[model samples]
Structures are given as structure tokens and as C-alpha cells.
Target: MRRMLLTFCLLSLLPVTYAVACLWDSETLEQERNKFPGTLEVITGNFPRHSPAFYQWRLDDRLNKLANDPDNDRWLDDVAVSYEKLGRHSEAIEVAESQLQRNPDRYETLANLATFLIHDGQWEAGLRYIDRALEVNPDAHFGRERYQRLLVQYLLQNFPDGQVEYPLAAGDRIDFPTFLVNDQPPGEDGQPPKLSIEQRQAAVQGVVGMMRFSQHDHPVLLEVLGQLLTETYRPKVDAKQLAARCYLLLADSAASPATQAAYEQLAKKSLNLQATHKSGSEGQMGLRAVRRELSGELAAAKKRYNSIVLKEKRWIASGVDVEAAYRQYVNSVQW
Candidate 1:
């Protein structure tokens, strides 16, 4: 009876032990060995030299012979990258994994494999390989940078704020012109009409949402939002209110006292505009509440903001239809 009980206990502990082993061990490379079938159809169709298909053919020809040569390992990396660039992600992953089977300590191969996996939307699994690569060579700069980039990409995508399709990278700065459509007249030679204010707002909102969720501070994103508010002409939208909201968002990520103060000044200008405007009562009240919140009157501001939110179900909210109110207020002040 004692022997049987001991055997059963040992059997039960096997899975737990294995899980623990897998957790601490950098043997994912070993476990992934032979996981993917070693078969890929390389298309050799002729195309322009600059085309991906031409690059694929060239790489495929080299890979066929290089796969057998253990000394020429770097060529294998090139082939894998080319396969990825050509949208042959599965083949890229297979090539990378095969290379790892022969040379498991190749940090570059490991990093490349991680990137391929991430590109294929297998980020969690890919991150394990990144950690393994960094483990093998902590000083691998490319590997480390790739790992951080992947991490940021994952965070931006999975963040609760909003879904973003843009591929973000470190030191990546987007200019305002990139968001603007060409100046061609609408319907001339089939040219599309200019993007509406709502469309621009949506685009800017997507960017701000990503920045809001990003773990890393993004002053560039805040600056871009600020610039958009100041530069864009949306006749209906109250730019001041938008500026105030942007300033509040920027405050969270501001790195210096000067930056914070600048945001505060901008917020104050927006608040003053809202308070002085002869707009709808609800809009004025909402703006006052936001100002109060910014000015450290949190309890009253929260109550007012909450009341506005509760009333949103029945009426156009504070910020909506703000353009008409803005024009009315401006005309009133001017007259």
C-alpha cells in the first residue's frame, strides 16, 4: 500500500515539476525543434529586380545549397529575412528554427526567429525566444533592441485604450503632413475629397489612445496632438476644448516642470475661452467642471462631470456640436 501511494504521488507531481522546469529553463529552442514540418515550396517566378518575388528566387536558390553548409550560417539569416519580407512568414520561421537546431547559440538567428513569430501574431511565444536570445548573449544589441521593440508593439496593440494598426518603433516621429490628404481639389480627375473634421479627429484619437496606454512616455505624441489642435481648421469643433483635453492628457506624461507649466497654460486658455463663451449652458458647465478638476477642485468637478455623463444618454454631450456654439460665442463676442 505504501509503495503504491508513493508511486501515485510521484506521478501527480510530474506535470507540476515539468511546468516549473519549463518556466525557469531556456530550453524552448530544444522543445521547438522539429515542431514545424521541413517543407517549403520556393517560387522561382521571374520579376523585376526590385520586386519581392525576384528577391525570393535569389534567396531560395542560395538557401537550397546553403542549408547543407554549416560554415555559411549568415546566409541562412538573409534567406529567413527575405522570406519574411516576401510575406512567407511560415517559411521564415521554419528556416530560423532549422538554423537554431544546428546552432542553438546564434543570438541573431534567435532574434530573427522572434521577429518572424511576432510578425505572425505569435508574440507571447515569440517573446520566449527573445528572452532566450538575450539570455545567451546579454550584450547582443540588435537582439535587445528587437526585444524592446516587440514589447512596445505588443503593449500598444493589447492596450485597453483603442486598437491601433500602425507599427510603432523607438525614435519614430510622425510629421503632421503625413496625416493630411493632398491639396488636389475634390472630384478633379477623380481625386478624393479632403478628410472631414470627424475623420481627422478619429485619426488623432487613435494615436492619442495608443499613447495613453503606452507604458513608455511619449512626449512626441502629445506634441503632435497639440499641433493638430492648433493647426487644423475644423469650423464646427471647439479647438479650445480639444486643446484643454490634450493638455490634460499631456500632463500625465510630461517629463519636466516647463512642460507641465506649458500644458497648464494651454489648459487655462481653453478654460477661459469656454467660460467666456456664450455657448449652450450644458457645454459651459462641462467646461467649468473640467477647469475645476484641473484647478484642484476635484470633488465638485467629478460631480459635475458625472452629471454631464449621465445626461449624455438623452442629449448631445458637452463636446459634441461644439462648433455651432463656438461660432455663436465668437460672433457674440465680436458683435
Candidate 2:
């Protein structure tokens, strides 16, 4: 308990900054995206979750603003977003389509409309729009649209008969590697080629996009987040410990007791694997202390999430770039 408190204090003092790769400025961030042509670099810190009442208020507010100034098409995006949040995808689709008709080449409208279509279960239509959005501005949103494209392809491969469901939860239902690899040839050593940085970025982007637009704690996205972090990489935190936390969160949020146990077991396996890896610094803290620190970080993150999201006051961002703890939670743990 004392160690946990001390760890919490250390975490509390840490700055609440986002990953360097995900700075909110689109133009400046695009410079980073250019380095990796097709991969996504999601700021996951931009799209904060809001209550339905909050979205309704936003929708009403935007509608009023548009009423006063009919030429302001930007508000249309907000209106569509609000409708999407309220689970009125048909209305969202209409608003987005109207905007698209006015500005067919606008990447934001195209991308937003595509996502709305996907959420509405029009996968093919969404995929087509996504392709068009990419053609207009391939690097928009740090190349996030590509990840959406990849997701559509993945889902289509699984349910090829054109009948599918929304908010997909893979949950041990598919072999991820087989689908992701697309039958690529093995390496010269006869083993599968290691995952490229682009592939990892795409996977991370998929998870972020899902959490932002779909369900926040969707089990499948959480599992993918865990799997991605498990790959060897230098991160702000221990990768396996972070992966373990992802699995634990999956277990907690899982709908079934059996699923919970399965994730809990995965978490244990992640922890046990930690012992096999020698302390990288050759003199850093032991594995136990690292796990303790991870626990403190996760607890602090949950506290921050609750503090940001549990407010009674009606709130809306003053601008699209506004920061919220809800958005940073995914970055805090996953990055």
C-alpha cells in the first residue's frame, strides 16, 4: 500500500502531455506523417467522448448557428457528428451527404461521411468514400483514413457474403495474422516477415479510431491495443506491463464471465513473460517494482478518466483542438 501511494505520487507529478508523434496541429503533424507515407499517426487525444445529452446540446447549438449563417458548412460536420453520437446515423448521413454534394473534393467531409456510412452499416459505400478521401488528401488526419480502409477490408474478408454487423468484436473469432498478412511471402529465413512499422501504426490507428467513433472500451480494440504494445519497442512505459493492463481492462469491461477469465489469463501470461526479459538498462528497477509502477499509472489514469467524464455540468469544447482527459486516457496507457 505504501509503495502504491508513493508510485501514485510520482505519476501525479508526471506531465499530462500527449505522445510527441500526435501533436494536435494538423499541418505541423502532417510533417511527421510524411515520413511514413501510408501509415496512420493518430492523436487519439483529439476526439474526446461526451455524453448523449452533451452531443444533443451540441447538435442544437450547431443547428442554431447554421440557422443564423447558412453558408457555414463547418457546422454541418458538427451536426453530423452530433447525430452520429446520438445514434441517428441516417440523419448524420443526410447531413454529410448534403455537405459532400456542395464540396465533393473536401477531404474532411468525405472522411466524416465515410465513417458515418460505416457506422450505419453501409460498408461498401464507406469504403468507396474512404478511397475518394484518400485521393483528395492522402495524408489528412495523419493518414487515419487508411486505417479505416484497412478495417473495412479486414471485415469484408471475414464476412464476404455482404452480410455483416457493426461495432465488430472479434473476441477470438478470427485469426488476425492470417487476415492482416494477406498471404505475403515468408522472409528469407523461411519465417513470416516481422511486422513493419507501418503495419503497427495501422493497427494502433484502427484501435484509436474504433475507440473514438465506436465504443470506448470495445473488447476487440482493447485486445488489439494490447497485442500491438506487446511487440518489442521502446516506449515511455514497460510494453508488457502496459499490455497486461490492456488485457485486465478488457477483462473488467468484458460482458461475459468466461471472456473476463480468458483476458485475465492473458494478463497473467504477459506478466509471466516479463521475467524472461532481463532488465534492459542492466541495472534498472526489478520486475516487481515496474509492475507496481504500472498499477499506479493505470489507477491514476482511471481516476483522471472518471474526473473528466463524470461531471454533471453541460460542456462543449470551445474548439476542435481542446484537450480532455477522456482523450488522453488511450494515449496515456497505449503509447
Candidate 3:
């Protein structure tokens, strides 16, 4: 009890609106959990379950207090967040919705409510909360992360082995990464990344495919498609010119010189990303495989080039620079 009190007081920085005010603490100095206000246990990532009793005691005490004046207190949202942390989905949603109705514009409440909704697989409502968070702050990482995941889920359910585009407030689609290997990749800071790896891959694939499916080409598609292909040919690969494939395709299909340049740049980034996979787990067998595969002659790449040509040109009826993609295509081809 003494240790937990000290820990709680220690973490409480200057109050910043709801973030700190939301936590519970002892009423008297040096006391803990006997007379606290809020129901949140606050088991943050760094603080593990070292004191389960302390948290439970606090929660129980707070629950009793709330039962007395449940209609007036705004602790429901905090309780919901705590329930979510404990994987108590049903209770979390109940509290989250209750809080949301009380104060519809309270973004924090809506965001917390949405989390439980997603956990409960109530996606349509979850997306509404996500949009609420975005409206509060388009860069809200937590909201965007949840929102992005829901979008993928919606797509998967609607289109098995198909894809859709999410209209993000920042933009319609992300600026695809060029092929390079950076240990800690940077993405939109406050935008939460989707959790499912397969879902993310599928979403990327859908966007890339849509760009190609368009007869009238989209210049932005090359960058987006390049990122998908880069991830597709993932780690521990040997000569997966999936990087070059993206480049070669973009190079052929690009409508103008400027667009072709963008393709070249995006493709180069892909190769660099692939390079990060080389020369780890150094064993004789692994080394042999790497040597055999990396050193092997790359078969002449025609399918990739042809796809790009057809893709970039079909859309550029309005005088696109066909030569730009053509020159880049010829340069990349190895007989």
C-alpha cells in the first residue's frame, strides 16, 4: 500500500485536463484506495501487475462510490477504458455508450467508446467514433489506428480477395514508401497503424490493384503500389526484384516524364527496402542459399514491364510522355 501510494503520487504530473484528473488516489495524504474518486486502475504499459490487490481495491471502492451518484459523475468513460485494458469488452461498451450519450461532443469519451465497439466487432459504430476522434484531431493516432483497422475489416467482409480505398482526412491514400531499410520505420505520428498484418497487406494490395485496374491511370498509384509490392516481397528474400518489378512497371506505364521520374524514385526506394533483408543469420547453409539466389541470373522481366506499359498508357489519352516510361523500361530490361 505504501509503495503503491508513492508510485501513484510519483507519476501524477501537473494536471492536464482529463488525462491526469481522470486517475484515482487516496483522499487523505499518505492514504491509498480507501477514498479515491475515479474508477481507473491505470495499469500503463511500463507499470505491470505488481499490485493487483491495490488496483482491485481501488476499483471496488470507486464502483461503490459511483453507484451512489451514478447519474451525475462522469467516471463512466474512465471505467470503460479500464475495462478495455482488462479485456472486459461487454462492460466497456456499456459504460462507453452511456458516457457518450451524456456528452456527445466529448471526443475522449467517443474514442474510448469506439475502442470497445471495435473489440465487440460493432464496426459501423466503431467507425463513427473513429470519425469523431479524427474531427477532434485528424492526427489522433489512437483514433486513426482504430479507424484504419475498421476500414480493412469492412473491406474484407464485403470483398473476399478484393479491396477498397479509405478517405483519410490527411489525404485519400498514404504516400507509399520508397524501397529502403530503416529499422524503426516512420509513419504518421498520431495515426495509429492497423493491427492485422494480413489485413494491412490486403488493403495495400487493393489500392495497388485499383490503380492498375483504372484504364485512365492515376499518377499517385505508382507510389502506393510500390509500397504494397515492397512489403509483399518481405524480409529474408533473395533477389526479390519485387522492388524492380514495381519500378519497371511504373516506368512503362507512366504517362509523362515527371510521372516516370516519380516511378523511378518510388521503385529505387523499393530496392533499398529489400536490401535491408540481406546477410543476416550467417551460417554456411544460409550463406550458400543467399549466394545461390542473390548471385543467380535474373530471368528476363517481361510480364512486369508489360503490365506497367498497359497500366500507365491506358489512362494518358491526354498527351502523356510515353517515352519517359519507355526509356526507363528499356534500361531496366536485361536479356
Best by TM-score: 2
Write one digit per residue (lDDT tens) for candidate 2, span 60-167.
778989988865778888898889888899999999888877788988889888989988778999999999999999887776787678767777777677664322
> For candidate 1, lDDT tens digit of each residue in 1-335?
99999987887777642322212111321231112111000000011112343345547556777868845767887788788778789999998999888889888898788878866767666778878887888755522333244333444344424333221111343334233444446666674555566654554444444343221124444444444444322324324444455566565446667666666665554444233233444333244445443455334434543543344322333434433443354355421
Error of 1 at 93 (Å): 0.6
Model 1, position 163: C-alpha lDDT score: 37
Off by over 4 Å in 3: 1-58, 68-74, 142-335
Instruction: Give the alpha carbon lDDT tens digit for every residue of 270-334 in model 3.
Output: 44422223334421122223223323322212344345546444424434444364456546754
Compute the lDDT of residue 14 as modeled in candidate 3: 36
User: Which structure is stronger by TM-score: 1 or 3?
Assistant: 3
TM-score of each: 0.33, 0.65, 0.34
User: lDDT of all predictions, in order shown?
Assistant: 0.49, 0.61, 0.43
Displacement of residue 201 (Cα, Å) in model 2 is 4.1
How far residue 48's Cα lies from its native spot in candidate 2, in Å, is 5.8
* Of 1 and 2, the candidate ranking higher by lDDT: 2
RMSD of candidates 1 onward, in order: 30.1, 12.4, 27.2
lDDT of 3 at 137: 66
Better of 2 and 3 by lDDT: 2
